[model samples]
Target: MRVPVQKQERYIAIRNVTILSVVANSLLTIVKITFGIIGNSHALIADGIHSFSSLAVDAMVLLAAKYSILPPDTRHPYGHGRYETLVTLAAGLLLIVMAIGLFSEAYEQLVGHKSPSEPTSIVLIIAFAAIIIKEAIYHYTVYIANQVNSPMLVANAWHHRSDALSSSIVVISVLGYMAGYLWVDAVATIIIASMIAYVGFEECLPAINKLIDTSINKDKRIKIKEIAESVNGVFFMHKLRTRKMGINILVDMHIVVAPRISISEAYKIAETVRHNLLDEMEEVVDVLVHIKPENTMNSLDLPQRNEITSRLQEQSIEVVEKIEKITLHYVDGKLLLDIDLPLNIIQNNNQARFISQQFADFAVNDPDIYAINTYYHGTVYDSPKVFQIDELHDFIQDKN
Candidate 1:
């Protein structure tokens, strides 16, 4: 199936934002690394490394976005959206590693009592410029991330903001070092590293939660329940489960309907609930609805479809041959059978009445089957139409 328009738009937005991040990180990396080397500022060099790591994350985001948008295939029937979640997890782990490295470097510098080298005016200028540019990129990236509802992009955006915050600290440390507070540079690095680690942990927790198929929040669950109950034929809903797949949500729920309704009507009610969720909620990718009769919710002992079919086959070979479909409705601890059969086999009222009586007799002996109803369809070459229950009743009565 072709992808929906909204999803196509989301993919396009993700691609554009990821490309923007790549361009911004590339420029920032070059500038910071070049100036850090020329001006002899270890802090700026460290910040440059941070920016370079962001470039790696940007690449990951691009790759994830590309693969996650592919249509579902046999191998991965749920689509490839989880690739984005995996990429997000990888990005979080990278952030934590970088944080640990920075913390170690800072600890060594502080404990070794190394005197900090004062950054030149050029280094200060570049650092301040980087702070402004990086923050701007952070806001832009976050905006796009929200627009696309991508956790991967959101993680990348925070990475950009962390760099900006690191640059801010770098400027302060450079000035403090120039003013004779030699420990300030190392202290600043420690603080920046801590922030990076915190952000990394924040990102990792959500990604792990999704990887484990954690349900959506209680409020969202309630909202879904309400939406389901709003459908016309739905008596109620239960067994509603939800989980995240990257940006999209997958929902599975059981909806209870009146036992007397036609199978097609029950199916339509389920479809309505699914469509309402897709229309009313953002990021919902698919809904799997199971229809149940209202009276069956509390019942425990019920025959499986195959067992019921086998019993019907055993009871009457003619039923097995003539019936096109058999639907069992369990209500109030009883089973109601709806059987569809071809009209041509029952030539007149006498045949219809005879088969009806046979089905009723079979049900009378079987404690589980409380009722039986049959529908008739003309032969494909003759009429190619199934008569409604009321119409079939009238035809049988007229023949009588």
Candidate 2:
């Protein structure tokens, strides 16, 4: 869940920046359009149209930033951050389309050598002011962008830049044309159009990069791996993927460790890594760390083996390692023993067999004795009589 914090601060920051951008663009658009009509300069009018693009971009910023912080929903479990990116990309595409249209219009004028007669002084002053003011807006937006790690804000910053560049082109073209050089205006418009293309390219490329899951670079990848592997009992990571979701990053990976470790410990390590990632880089929305165990089944087998090993090790002094099994027989007072004795000592066959039979023989022959049958697993095993015959057997006493 995306718990929305810093909402007021973020809203004020975005709202003020957006208002500033809109005011600047609107002012520039009105001023340029008025001067273009009075001065009879279509290139200046075209520049006004280019500046108009900022209105939509600013609107996008306001709308995008508002929705970006909305809490996660069932439909959007990842929150609405990507909506901001999509809007920014749309704004960039809109700019590119408008620039292309301007290029086509400028191309006709270029071929005709159409001279633009304009009253230069007012337009030049306003254009210069637009440049300074827009650049200021750009810097301010960039500051906010860095502060919040917001891609939408960054896009808005460059939108201000595009406006400044468009205004500069208008100033150059109008000033040069006022000096009676006709060709400079069209050339300037074309140059600004190319810059528009560059801006479009820059904005679109990152969106594509994000969509493609571009590596978060090799240095960071190695660092993340090192962090995960450094935790005690964690072997390594697999499928360590990192990609941007808006300005924030989405990381998913498998964190491998010994299987015997408890879930709480695994969660602790994963939590540590997640916190470190978030602390070190604020632009991470979600990190999914999958806990993987080394060998799952071997963990179950070791306990049973360890339990029997412990029992025998406690019983005898000379024994190094032994395997033993106990079975109660149908016959009354009897226990069967299956034993495998290790070869640390040089003992004769009889001695080895007797050693294997040691527990059953001792237990059975006692007055409380059950009849005992023993199997010598390490040596040859033999079937033995169930119990010894006593003198009473000759009497053939009937028994039910």
Candidate 3:
């Protein structure tokens, strides 16, 4: 949502600057060239070329700004801000070329040693007038660029300034010719050329950085780290990578947290980090948080399991001979119970052998006892087993 708003503002900035630059170029170019040709001033004509250079930059800025604000697509999920950088680099190349052309032409005029004619009153006034108007455009264009956070527009505005500065040089050179000093015009041309080349180099540096996916500066790093640390569960961060596509910045990083934290809590921590980043940094287009957990939670689980087992065992004891050691074991804090009882009542083999010899009635006559099996007192005795029906029958007999 915030993205749409930022993009719209940048679009407006681009449209306004392009219109201003184009209109200014059309007016200034004609005015400078008309005076330049009439006055027989080669330097003034080169200044007219500088005005034309604004048209080139205007095209670059218009394209760069409009494309930079485009929504992310499949190929460029980070949006189109890098297109702005590329166009800016292109603008830089144009500036260097224009400056070289201006210098070469100026050098030829100066060395050829022609006696230059004086400019009419109209040409001098109009050339100087162009300087004033260009300077104003520079200020306004740059002002809007900063307001909307458009780097491409900022670069274009500087292009305007370079033009204005060259025009001032033109004014000085033409005046030098009128004074018949001559060499000052060549010197000023050289300075203006150097100035353009310097600005061109400056524009190229950032474009190259963005083209190569350069890391964001320490300032942005510090901001993201601060945000990650501010969240409660996050203990640290790793794999913090950031890059720019246009105005949009992509953030991919790992966050560390305690292991015992549940899925929902970890999600909340990530959400907080993402929200704070987007809120604080309007340029950020997307955030991907990979959370890691501390390894200590597994150790704590064993002791907790033993404690639960110990508590459940307390509800599981009874007299061995009286009921085969069978007893009820309550689980779920005694809200549920498990019945355990033995199937056999006797274990001695000698008594079973004697009972088989015409003492079957004695065995059957004992109403207090039930099913018995011959085991280790005659065949090794094993632990008594639990019987399912013993609890019901024993309870009824005891009550009766």
Highest-scoring model, lDDT = 1
**Residue-wise C-alpha lDDT for candidate 2, range 267-386, written one tens digit per residue:** 998888777766665566678898876543223322243443454466553543543443332122222233433332323444444553655545445443344443333222222222
TM-score of each: 0.79, 0.69, 0.70
Q: Which candidate model has the greater TM-score, 1 or 2?
A: 1
Candidate 1 clash pair list: none
Clashes of 2: 1
Ranking by TM-score: 1, 3, 2
The reply for model 1, stretches above 4 Å from the true place, is: 1-4, 297-329, 336-366, 369-400
- Which residue pairs show collisions in model 3? 81-245, 81-246, 82-245, 82-246, 341-386, 375-379, 376-379, 376-380, 376-381
The model with the greater TM-score, 2 or 3, is: 3
List the RMSD of every prediction in angstroms. Answer: 5.2, 14.1, 15.8
* Model 1, global lDDT: 0.83
Error of 2 at 330 (Å): 38
Winning model by TM-score: 1
Query: Quick one: RMSD of model 3?
Result: 15.8
lDDT of 3 by residue, 191-288 (tens): 88898888888888888888898988899988998988788899998889998776667889989887646679999999899888888887776888
